[model samples]
Target: MADKPSTPLLDTVNSPAELRALPREDLRQLADELRSEMIDAVSVTGGHLGAGLGVVELTVALHTVFDTPHDRIIWDVGHQAYPHKILTGRRDRMRTLRQKDGLSGFTRRAESEYDPFGAGHSSTSISAGLGMAVASDHLGTPRNVIAVIGDGAMSAGMAYEAMNNAGAMDARLIVVLNDNDMSIAPPTGALRTYLAKLVSGPVYRGTREAAKAVVQKLPPFLHEPARKTEEFARSFFTGGTLFEELGFYYVGPLDGHNLDDLLPILENVRDAGAGPILVHVVTKKGKGYAPAENSADKYHGVSKFNVITGAQAKAPSNAPSYTSVFAETLIQEARDDERIVAVTAAMPSGTGLDKFAELFPNRIYDVGIAEQHAVTFAAGMATEGMKPFCAIYSTFLQRAYDQVVHDVAIQGLPVRFAIDRAGYVGADGPTHAGNYDNAYLGAIPGIVQMAAADEAELRHMVATAAAYDAGPIAFRYPRGDGMGVDMPERGAILPIGKGRIVRQGGTIALLSYGTRLGEVLAAADRLAALGLNPTVADARFLKPLDEELIARLAATHDVVISTEEGGLGGFGSHVATFLAANGLLDGKTRFRPLMIPDRFVEHASQADMYAEAGLDRTGIVNTALTTLGYDQAAMTAALAKI
Candidate 1:
């Protein structure tokens, strides 16, 4: 954008300390500059733009009012923390967001002291902040702990759970309710600002405490009613009845974009006597930038884009995404069966269920950020003979693990889980990586887990999950476009728990579980170049291990390698377990499972991550060669020739 917009005020401040030192009147100018810098940086790097843009003034106000590093500030989900990052001495690293060995898109504890708690998944700020506040109290170091949470995140029960705990313990915690999505309280003018400041100030707090003291002396029956009357009178005007009920001193419905409104209210909040305070700050999503302000959802998570035109830069893809295939295929099945319903945890578009919702408007349920609720809701639907497909990101589905085990799996409900973004997610990194589905779902007894090899496989898996009305079934597919294979008009329901041989060849067998099938085939080609045509097979189901296929490959092939996209305890782990139990690893046969390493791989391109994990073609070929008794030097030499 204009070769990086000039940010004189932003450049002058290296950290929040400098930001605080500036004249109070100049803070608005500083915020403007900060917003510009964030906009430019995100436009280049591509990240959570709208959220960050929305919280520009709030970030500035929080940093200015609170003595951060000493005072803790936790941003829920960390989507809006980019501006916070810039103000907190990470201004220089803004360009490196979500890149390999670069700054994380989400707040990371490892990144800086400014980031006290890391958050990638939604609705964890209050819990983490409360824990920090409790720790601080126990240590006798009472510092202000402010948790900035979005309205979307508040839908999750964990936020309330933390608040309930905080209220019970009377922990000094400040929860800044950044209400940008839902219109909880739209009024943000002078009157609202005045009331917010007045209520949060010492005078109002002291008066309230005195009133409570007078009420406490009354009859026990009258005391409860007196307290309720006081709260009811205030909440009638202020609109925080729910928060007040949860034992939080509620303030605001203030204009978050207005520094004048935010600054004084935050200062009052910081200085006020608080057991647990909820400051409701209402702001517009994508506040400053016109493009984002117009279409906030589109800019929520963007690619590199033009500052003037707001057009994102996307690489041309020949095939549809696996998420789209799942949606389209599900739609195809739903057309035939009216009982089909879809569910998503605040990610209808991300899971491609928005397409399904277009045709079956009443059937698709957007359950906000509550993953646990989404799972159980799907389970409830399934109990009624409705084919409920619960679509959620793999990492997010981890949040509903208990529900998966206790509700779906335990009840033996026929709930279909369409797990999207399974495997190494490119920019979002390990936090968003769908690496545990194969492990987690596989562990649940009677739960059938399948990983798609490509788009066609994803389509078939969707059909398969729809057709199979047994127990809980989950199908995982990686992020990004599929391999450009021939499209099937309508996916045929595949045989459950069956493995298929793709290429028949020599004594070296390369068995793949998921999208790694492409890499395995390429590795087979590489092996063919090395005069070793390996037998390539796709093990479709992770849970129902194909004993017959394993026996055939073990009996025939000298070297058998199992490749999967996820970490250990996945398809590879299952295959290894099957082979071990069957005594297939006894004599001359060597079985090696290639999956993600024990540790988390940082953010990178999918190809880079796969290659790093030894799940790429080169890695697969090397594994085959190494296990065949070839030394590192020999394998290196052989690969170089290929």
Candidate 2:
């Protein structure tokens, strides 16, 4: 018992440098302790578990080799940066990971000198590292810039664009392709097969370097011809022929876990003085832990869990989440309509398409992390008279904004966008928060946007998207459970560009959209207590908004308050625009647009997140009272009556 209480490995590690101070035999022990510490920290404060676990050895080796603060190392998506953060000075604060006013889940530039560029979304590392390398060259500071990107992120076009540009400029950048064979889920596309070949093959690495050296040693006049021959040889060997064409001297298919292999190769690449070299390191997701290794995706981003059992600590939810609801709804529709098909960008389970994929494997398209391709592909599917439902997270959809505007909206394709996580995502932090979808998406022409108040409404929205044969339609829902509303056994399509008046009132009208409708109802209850009968209207369709309802509400009610959980240019802003344009918001009529303040919302619990944004019940009541100039005494008395 006395011996169990004290662990030498735990005592020895204070930082990465200290870990590096240990012997080769002791370093493996240190890694074990580090992984244990990570598991312990994350079990208390839930976050990305499998990714960090998978990259433990790579993290250790990289820190052991590179001088971090001097040599820029950027982690793509930053979910796996927890280990990096712990290795770097933030170990003690591991318990505060993703908590409010604590350490961010992703790499933050402001957090420490070690973090070069902040990232949350995937596939931005290579481009950022290239910029750093170019800047380093220009400033006469030749520091090594490294981008460690996962295979899932490799699917995004931005990575290719970055690789293309970096290869063209011949920037001194080292891209570590951490192919764990999983990125959120198993990566998709032709590149995945190419990666599989590279990771599995043995001969690609040994002969390529010798061949490249022979080419370099040739005469200056024969260099171009020799280079082309070497290029053809690389194409034949690695089959990243495209990468060779882009100008990168591709290396690896190296064993990421084995420090013996990784360290030497990294040193060789560092010494070789190559231009924008890609070091493909193959790794297994959830390498050390049996439970995580067995089910990597399930453990990918876990809630607070029991260390012993690997069971989530949180109680099982009574109500189904919006994602599960969407999945079931899509399946029901697909069963009836042969044309209905579902598509996701490497998120079959996260987007709730796993069951759908299982049901109709051929109909489902898991397009890796390529959101742009997913949208355009769906548009192409729609053009051929197939009902394509492009289910994507709101934050990821930001990546495909150009595609949404150009392919789906402009072409008037009937591609259904099931935008999930359209509000404050708690622990994943601001980078993963889906706050701006409505505002940006609403600006697109020939596009219809709808927000569901609950699960039943989401089902209805799905039906609406399916039934509508004209143009693109987007329906957004929040992350968590529904309002316990009874779901329809079968979905029925609702009218396009129309709203439903949930509660009827007299002088004051509350126009709400999306999940904020719940808050509006709460405020309406308070108003009712004040003997102020407020009309509650759900503005279902954002574009081609219920103008008749707005006009009537403006004329009938003494004041009209528009509410939404999105930033300016969202539902509330659009309502304000409509009212102002129609001369409805005059000195006579009081109109207040209650929207999320124009700013970035940091990580916090959903309730705290909403309260901070002033989108809660109390905030709504305060806004109502302020607009009406009601005193505290009057408001309190009114509250008592309710």
lDDT of each: 0.89, 0.83
User: What lDDT is obtained when candidate 1 is compared to the true structure?
Assistant: 0.89
Assess the local accuracy of residue 220 in candidate 1 as a C-alpha lDDT between 0 and 100: 91
lDDT of 2 at 543: 86
lDDT of 1 by residue, 204-261 (tens): 9899899989988888989888987888888877998988878888997888888887
Task: Identify the candidate with maximal lDDT.
Answer: 1
Model 1 backbone overlap count: 0
lDDT of 2 at 274: 42
Instruction: Estimate the TM-score of every prediction.
Output: 0.99, 0.91
Maximum-TM-score candidate? 1
TM-score of 1: 0.99
